[model samples]
Target chain A: MRQANLEEETAVLGFLEAMEKGLSMKVLSGGALGVVERDGIQFAVLTSQALLSLPQDLLAGAEAAGLPLGVLEGDGFHLDLQGAALVAVHTKAQTCRVTEQAAKLFLYGRNVLGDSVVWHEPGLKRGDACIVCNGRGESLGLGVVVGPFKGMREAVKPVQDLGTYLRDQDE
Target chain B: MTEPDFPVARFAAGPKIREWSRKHGFSDWMVARILQLTDRPADVLEGLLHRPPRYLRANPLRASVEEVLSRLEAKNFSLARNELDPNILKLRQAPISPGATIEHMQGLTTPQDLASASAPLALGAQPGDIVADLAAAPGVKTLHVAGDLAGGGLRERGAIIAVEPDADRMRALRFNLERCGATSVVMRNHTAQELPGKAWADRVLLDAPCTGEGTIPKDKNRRHGKPEEVTAMAALQRELVDAADRILKPGGTLVYATCTFAPEENEAQVSRLVGKGYRVEPLGFDRVASVPLVPGVTQWPGLELDPSVARARHFLPGVHPTLGFFVAKLTKRERAI
Candidate 1:
């Protein structure tokens, strides 16, 4: 729950910067925000999550390694649906806006075929991270680019989607 | 998968008992217990085998009650407003699972049971209070508390310290909070026993883990637990409540809730707190109570509990339309100087 050190700060921004050029601290910085780890996954948390209700002693203390509210959260960066949504709005990241039919398929844990991708970022290439969106430009999930954005082959591999919660319930 | 062998040897399986148990898919012991607890055993038995009416609550962080209602209505889904909470809508009928709908994907709404949705609000979390949610996993109640603290995610400056010890459930909790945009929470992975003590929280909510007998309708496996499992769970619940008491500020509200009808887990646990002189308070939710609630039981066979347990309410499935749940509210006693 401590403030994100310079190294952690740089690493988070660096991961995002690759997707959207010039994505720096100015665009990413919200007051009193920092990265914290839980179960080996990284999250950017608001200061409230860091501040314990009681003061902590070195020997015994309670702290929040959790985030306050959303904080444009990430869990493993690429596989985080919330983080992808945050990235889509805040930065001009690589995105593929899918058609209604394709959005339904993707939500069912299917990869995005070229025919279903109505529009995609012109700069997308193989192995790049992409945010999958619906007709309203709302994020559906995060994906990994499989081929050229305009190519007819399967283009984005679905890594995470909003339907995950539902699928988990089914099990 | 094949069904697990249901334990059925405890009760005397009379002809009538055998017929009723076979009809309701309950073991002889469960049928005998139900008959003991309710005059309308048929109603209770039927409730255990079928799902209750589906319900969903509008997420203020993503959409308004009016907006959610309008959208769902446009989808031709019949809906009704829950008598307890207006923002919660009961699904009369739907073309698909509510979870697959666009509204859910947009975080505009969350599908939760009417009873489960009401548990956290019992704490009455306000804008500035520092609330603690012990055993908060899968984030349903945590999301509600966070929204209340944020005044529906519109403003900030409230905090919820949510603790869950399970790793897999913890992941689901984080994802749920992020999806709903409820930002006033601080997640902690520590067990209830591990929380540091300063009696600092303004309110504490311990939705203690229980046998989940209340969820029998949707999950059949709940009916198959061994008799001793309830006792073992009650032991764990006691440990959890002890931690909740430790972190609660003097005079702070402590809400203890469970989803089982076991007297040991319900009345016995709360009665222990009352014995410590924690004053029992009315839940104050009587007016909006969606279903009839009986007073907490004072005696379970051989055990005669204090009358103070009556301050709590029980939401029995046959008696109430929802699950068989119990909720008790208490105010921590001030320390003597």
Candidate 2:
């Protein structure tokens, strides 16, 4: 639990900016950026620690209304379900909609097959972290793209999915 | 001639009450109280004897309602849309425990009954309002407030300061909030009575601890309660309500609720607040319109309360499928009496 460093912050901002050209670090509004490193993963979190205890006027307000952002993993940022929602709310994050079968499989933590892809937004290249949506355009989680789009083999490796929260929760 | 006296109401006490209580596997006090709570005592008692159906509230932040419902249907789950409460999905059947499903893991849906779900709606925290759940533990309602309602006010995320006194329950609270990916929730571990700071939150929710009489269908032990026990619980609830009023910003809304039907903890508590000049407000929502709820119990033989306490609503166990829950909303005064 520490404030994110300039280097770590820049890396995350760069990754998000590269993935979605319109998205900026402005989404982290009203929340302080912090890092919680566990199991060799530095998880980036947006929190209201700075403002929660103090009195807040309704007028002097800047709200970072939804979720704390990215889960910075091994090397690059692998935005988890919470993080994916953070970036996608206003402008869509780099995303791909998958079939119902693929969505179910993806939720089970499996890599999605190329055939499972219903459609994907352009500008996302191989190894880029992308938001995975079900056929109804509901996000399953973040996945790392592995080209080519039209193939019979694995196209995206799931780095984090929604089920991760259920599995990782404390009893 | 003997069966004609089966009019349970005509012979309310002694043998009649005892026989009804024994027949329903409830204590005499519980049976007698239920009889007084409603004219349809048989229906209420019968409702407590059986298992109730489960319902789910899909987190829109995670998935679209259409997608989540369609996906679950594919998994052999028989679900029906609850026409009464459009936001809830009634689980007709499930192949596995709904809690163990992948959709639950994805933070997509939660097993929230209609009554418990109504508290946050009653508070009506705007998207960016600073909301405090005074007794937040195993944070089911906190998750709803922060995720689905104004707490998630997705653009300018409002904040939730969740306070749970017990460490073990706080762990469970933390788990539910994380499981739902509910954002900007600040969790504190301590009793609300001694919680530091004041007048910080724009809205406060004290879903206080109660006798849990409404849970008889799920856990039968709650069907028996002593009057002294309710009085003891009321003392603690009053303390928590005081804490809620202390921290809530002037002009903020405070929703004090419980999952029980006890007047000692329900109307009596609200009547105390109104005695202190707290302006009681209606739980302004159409969601509760279809719930078979009656006005808050204003009088309980020798214990008459302020008529304003009637603004509180009780979702009766017999009349409503959900727990016999009680909810009251009030607007804080600029200066306390």
Which of the numbered candidates is closest to the native, going by highest TM-score? 1
**Model 1 Cα lDDT, one tens digit per residue, A11-121:** 556766766676544333332454555545455654443243334431122233433312323322332565566566665568889988889888899988877888887
Clashes of each: 1, 3
In angstroms, the error of model 1 at B189 is 3.7
Identify the CAPRI category of the predicted complex in candidate 2: incorrect
| Model 1 C-alpha RMSD to native | 5.7
lDDT of 2 at B202: 88
What's the lDDT of the predicted structure labeled candidate 2?
A: 0.72
Candidate 2 off by > 4 Å = A1-8, A18-43, A47-66, A71-78, A84-160, A168-171, B1-13, B62-85, B92-103, B147-153, B179-181, B224-228, B285-292, B301-304
User: Clashing pairs in model 2?
Assistant: A65-B156, A65-B157, B44-B318
Error of 1 at B185 (Å): 3.5
Model 1 chain B weakest 10-residue run by lDDT = B1-10
**Ten residues in sequence with the least summed lDDT for candidate 2 chain B:** B1-10
Each prediction's fraction of true contacts recovered: 0.24, 0.29
- DockQ, per model, reads 0.24, 0.21
